[model samples]
Target: MTDFVQSARHTTEALRDLFEATPLQRNDHLSARYGAEIWLKREDLTPVRSYKLRGAFNAMRKMRAARPDLGHFVCASAGNHAQGMAYACRHFGVRGTIFMPVTTPQQKIDKTRTFGGAAIEIVLTGDYFDQTLAASQAYCRDQGAHFLSPFDDPDVIEGQASVAVEVLDQLGRAPDLVILPVGGGGLASGVTRYLRAAAPGTAFRFVEPAGGASLRAALEAGAPVTLPRINSFVDGAAVARLGTHTFDALKWADPAQVLLAPEDRICITMLEMLNVEGIVLEPAGALSVDVLPVLADEIRGKTVVCVTSGGNFDFERLPEVKERAQRYSGLKKYFILRMPQRPGALREFLNMLGPQDDITRFEYLKKSARNFGSVLIGIETKQAGQFALLAERMNEAGFAYRDITGDEALAEFLI
Candidate 1:
């Protein structure tokens, strides 16, 4: 344990060549809301807008040191890691060939290319990530280039430990609790291992995307397990399985210590941070803060640190994020309404809406009979209770409707 922390601290010190330590700021907004001393380790402020560069740079530098002839690197990433690797490759003057799924947003591809400049080549292959990964690996083997695993490698884990080392040094003490967002478990495992060794008193709670609760599964199963399905909304942290190296360090955590951040609920946190704090956060970046309400009582009066992992969010998805957040918060809804064909029927139904209710979407599906039709209605309101009131009014008026806001299957197919 002593040797491990020593190595981590050394790595943290060496990272100064690339960039200054990311700031550890106390968050006034969250502190007041939760009645706790809430601090934010703003990993999102790094040069690459994420802590990924820490590991990438560390691994690349160490590998080059061991084998000076190794000048080429290869990686498969659809997001932040690719950018990080690109930046590091440019810094080292090494050739980097990054493979990304064809479906990757052009915004991300452009950013990665810009970061690497002449040091990297971008390849777009396969519609899915798994296929892209396979292609990158084959290319790496063919060219004798080192392949960088985002989280699985020992040196990468050591690199990620730099985050924890900075947190404790900057705060001048171990926080009572450190909240982390887990993807393939690199950051969480590195941070947890460092803190456990350096400050034995510090506690931790891990957060995973609800749809990709691989850590929770690993903890319960006593080994890593692949989930059958996972929602990719939190793209940065959505991994089907925990990395073997990461799970080794994290296996000590109890299943209860892991929290699930629902994808929709994470959007609310992203909006809040952006609007209130002027901090832009990607969906994965907001996971640590998104789970705060669930730990409100437990965290009260304690010193807590939440790692905001990344901020590479593309503004193009803002509307979708807002829509999801509103739905989860009960401020918006979608339903199928049975409307009568009479001339006065539409006006009567409109009267049921409260003053704050505004119709965002309205479409007639089909006029099945001469007397009635099925209409899709979407309403946005200030409060959730208004929906119940509107439903009651509709019932009394002998109208029929079905709420489809929470129905995923129906929403994908119809909405």
Candidate 2:
């Protein structure tokens, strides 16, 4: 075995003392839909409801053993990593300090505290993640404590390789393709390294949130480069830059193998998994599965494994997810209409609605002028093509209207 694979096996073996391996269950629903043997590596079912705990446990154990006097640990994270570190602190009975962005949700902070109990101190600082990370590192340096990186450390990468080890053992053979979700690239790097050494024939496809395509950018640049701006819709995997260590390990991957998933399109996958299969996945965790349709031809009749990375979704975001899915699928739209001030003008406009079209929202934006009034309307239809017909009817009737459904900037301000 290669050195990295050997080390990964050792880490996997050692991790058993903390928790049982996450399940690699064959998904009948997905298999039937795609004509493939589809398996979901349920990292969502882990103790922390994420695979992050594996890396935290493995790294802490190794660090404590090597430096017997190490008594404290520090880390900065907005979600999963914070919970993992908290659980590890409680498990090892060591003191830990966790730094989180001020904008992090209260639910995540509460859960982290619950997992860590009295073993951890939570520090809420900084408006953004970079600020929080820098603060955590400085605190660690000043206090002589070890700062635990979420994915940039070699030990953490080795620990994440355990996911691949479990998959190979549970399946009894290498999968034809392993679909991995990439953020800072710890899990992707580790899994690829281990699998490349142990089963060179296996293939890999890396998925990233389109709004935060850090890995794709790095591969294109031939090195890691911070994106000037990033959308935080997929909060779990919305990293601006790929980690240096992770990129080093994954530098050889084919640029074409990296796929970027639209953040709004991922909402469709999240809703499908929740409604049809009774499975809930956060946007980041659903990345691999979201790209399945794009790879339908290549994966037909092949054994495919998708790593469902995390399930830290809050029910409060359900409405937003549904709205995004509707917008992406063209089932919903918003338009501003100029209505004539004639006696039967309202009736004439109402008559333009097709049988399947339903008005979800209607409001008069302006009525000061007697000649015409502006109306803000939101319509939902059973079919996406209905919008084209509706537009044609509006044009033929000489009803002035502007569709603002796909206008991001305008929608943000008005919709």
Candidate 3:
């Protein structure tokens, strides 16, 4: 057997010391929808509700095994990684200090504390991730504690390879295509490395958040580069720069195989999975599944596996997710209307509404002109076609209106 294959197998066996293998289940809804055999590696079902624990556990285990006296570990994360490290620290009976961004949600902070219990100390540092990371590393260096990199270490990479080992064993055969969500590329690098050695024929597609396409950027630049700006909506997978170690492993990947998922579109997929399949996936977790429709033609009749990376979704974001999904699917709209300042004119505008269109929000703004008033309106409809009909009716009535639904600036300020 190849060295990588043997190493990954050994790691997989060792993981049983921490927790059982996460389930790989055939997804009926997705399989039927795409006309392909679709399986989900349910990493969300892991103890910390993410595949992150795999690498954390493996890294901690090997560190302790090699240096029996090493009793302190440190890491910086605002979400899943923190929980993973905390859980691993407790498992290893070691002291760990986790630094987190001050802006991290209370829900995530609570979850991390619960996972680590007394074994891990939670430190709230800077407002940004970079600052938190720097603080953690500095603390580790000064205190002589081992710093656990979230994705950029060789040990973490090897630990992540255990996922591929379990996948091959669980599926009985290598899938034709494997869809992976990319952040710093740790999971993708590790899984691809092991799979390439074990099942040379399997193909791969890498998905990243559109606002944070670090892998695509690195591939194009022939090296890792930091993005000037990144949208952190897909926090788990929205890394601004690919890690050096991870980029080295993933450098050979074809740029075309890297797909970008828009943050809004991901919300639609999250809602679909939650409502249809009863699967609760965070923005990053739903990425692999979100891209299935984009690859419907390519994946049809092929055995495909999508790694649902994490399920650490905060339920408080449900309303925002639903709103974004509605807007993306054209079920919701916002518009600015020039309405006449008269009672009968308001009645006339109300008459133009189609049967399926319902007014969700309406506000008449004070105007200097006595004859006209500006109105902000939010409408919900059963179908996108209803909007065209409503627009036509408004035009016939000589009502001046502009659809602000897709105007990001206006929508952000007004909605």
Candidate 4:
């Protein structure tokens, strides 16, 4: 092995002092379903419930070794990164200042506090992460404290490479394919870099949340480019732009190898894994597995390894996840009904419902309409096909209604 690969191996060995290596398990369910030998590198089972801890711990350790007197570090993150930094700081017995967006969930804030204990101080600032990041950097520079980047630093990237090192040692051989979930490109870059040297024949597929496809954008643009907007549903992996250091490592990646997972569709995978496999995965954690159906043809009979990146999901979001999954599968729907104000109209509308359909919501929007009233209605059905039959019956009964389930603007405003 070259110097970098050898160093990564040493780093993996050193990590044993902090925590045991995560499992690389053969998932029979996924294997059977995909017609391939599918294994999951369970980074979700890491001490911080993410691979972020590896980078955080490694960066902190290297910094401490170089500057023995360095006692303070700062980082900005809204989720996993903050928790990782906190955990690392506590391990190193160093002080850390973690900046989080003002809108971060209470559960995340509490978890970070728990991980750091007295070793870290959390400063909640700015409504957006960019603002929070800037504030943290400014504080670091002004105080002459070392700043820890979530994904940009070389030491952090090297730390992440340890994941690949463990994979090789555990699997005993390189799989034909490696599927990775991408955020700012740290894990993808680190893993791919090591694998290219260690397992030259292995292929790779990178998955990114559609709303935050920074890696794909960077590959296409020949550099990192900030997206105009990002959907934060996959909060752990929804980065607006790829990191410069990460991009440098991944510059040779082919755009075709990158796949995008829709935010809504990701929820379906999350629910399926939870219900069927008893595996609770956050949206970002499920990214590598969520794209299996799309790769079924190519991966048939091949050995595929998917990295389940993180499991820091809050159970409180279960309802929202279920709702999104239902909507994506067409099992749930919402509509605006224009109803006659006259008596018996309501009963007639109720009579048109299918036996397997349940009305979950019905609210009168304009009760004072002279001849007609507008009503907002939500319906849940046993099957997606039921909606077509329901629509046909509605038409036959002369009921005027508009399906607003897939209408983004109306759904946001009304539902």
Model 1, residue pairs in steric clash: none
lDDT of 1 by residue, 319-392 (tens): 99999999999999999999999999999999999999999999999877798899999999998999999989
Candidate 2 backbone clash number: 0
Over all chains combined, what TM-score does candidate 3 have?
Answer: 0.97
Tell me the tens digit of each residue's lDDT in model 3 across 139-258.
Answer: 999999899988998789888998899999999999999999999999999999999989999999999999999999999999999999998999999899999999989999999999
Candidate that would win on lDDT:
1
Worst 10 residues of 1 by lDDT: 363-372
- lDDT tens string, model 4, 221-284? 9999999989999999999999999999999889999999999999999999999998878899
Candidate 4: residue pairs that collide: none
lDDT of 2 by residue, 1-415 (tens): 4888888989999888889999999999999989999999999988899889988988999999999899999999999999999999999999999999999999999999999999999999999998999999999999999999899999999999999999999999999999999999999989999999898999999999988999999999999999999999998899999999999999998889999999889999999999998888999999999999999999999999999999999999999999899999999999999999999988888899899999988989998988999998999999999999999989999999999988889789777
TM-score of 2: 0.98
- Tell me the lDDT of model 4 at 237: 94
Kindly report the root-mean-square deviation of model 2 from the true structure over all alpha carbons.
1.2
Model 2 pairs in collision: none
Off by over 4 Å in 4: none
TM-score list, all predictions: 0.99, 0.98, 0.97, 0.98
**TM-score sort, best first:** 1, 4, 2, 3
